[model samples]
Target: MKKEIHPDNYRPVVFKDMSNEEIFISRSTVNAKETIEIDGVTYPLVKLEITSSSHPFYTGKQKLVDTAGRVDKFMSRYGNRNKNK
Candidate 1:
């Protein structure tokens, strides 16, 4: 691991907008524009979609979580499939 041999691995790292201490970096943007600062260093933010926040899972309170129309699609596909029968 020679310093001179290493070609100055200087690159930009991404940090999620308004995150506590989490950070990420990639080649492409996942979503709209956002800004984040880490250790006094500012960087562009990316996707921050939450699957489970202060919801049921973390608190061990398993609850039915319906998405947009998953159940509707399932019912429409399988439920109505045997209607003519």
Candidate 2:
């Protein structure tokens, strides 16, 4: 409640390059580089590689587990099996 001693808490925070599904409630956690432009006003845009829209878990689509079949092959080689059984 002290004046002139409080930290600056009034700064514009915006996250850029977010997926279309996460833009409405998205806010930047810290200052980031963004290059956003709207109505002649431009700001920095954040670039994200993946979000709920692109993530495999959130979208309910399983990602390709390329190593899955390899595991079976390994087990067969290491594990001993009875020839008649």
Candidate 3:
């Protein structure tokens, strides 16, 4: 708990998740160039690439990779060489 070390310019800021377009309002000392109006109030808008609402772990929306297709492709390209040796 240090005094005069923390910033004193805490203000309301809006964080917008770019991936899912989720907006959250919280107090922060970070600066932002863009402004947005929400619920008749204006707040500094900050754009983020990922947030809890859009994150794979939080939203439980994991991307499924086609591992079988990749295996098949690898086998097609090099499987014959192994069989000859």
The collision pairs in model 1 are none
Q: Spell out the clash pairs found in candidate 2.
A: 16-46, 34-44, 34-45, 35-44, 35-45, 36-43
TM-score of each: 0.31, 0.43, 0.72
In candidate 1, what are the lDDT values of residues 1-85, reduced to their tens digit? 6658754544564744232334466545344466667789766676454333323565576656679988888898888766788
lDDT string for model 2 (1-85, tens) is 8889855654444453244534322444455665656567655455666776767788898765557688678668865565536
| lDDT of the structure predicted as candidate 1 | 0.58
Q: For each candidate, what is the lDDT?
A: 0.58, 0.57, 0.91
Ranking by TM-score: 3, 2, 1
Error of 1 at 61 (Å): 14
lDDT of each residue in 1-85, candidate 3, tens digit only: 8999999999999999998888999999999999999999999999999999988999899975677699679778987896887
TM-score, model 3 to reference: 0.72
lDDT-sorted candidate list, best first: 3, 1, 2
RMSD of 2: 5.3
Q: Is candidate 1 or candidate 2 better by lDDT?
A: 1
In Å, residue 5's CA in model 1 sits off its true spot by: 27
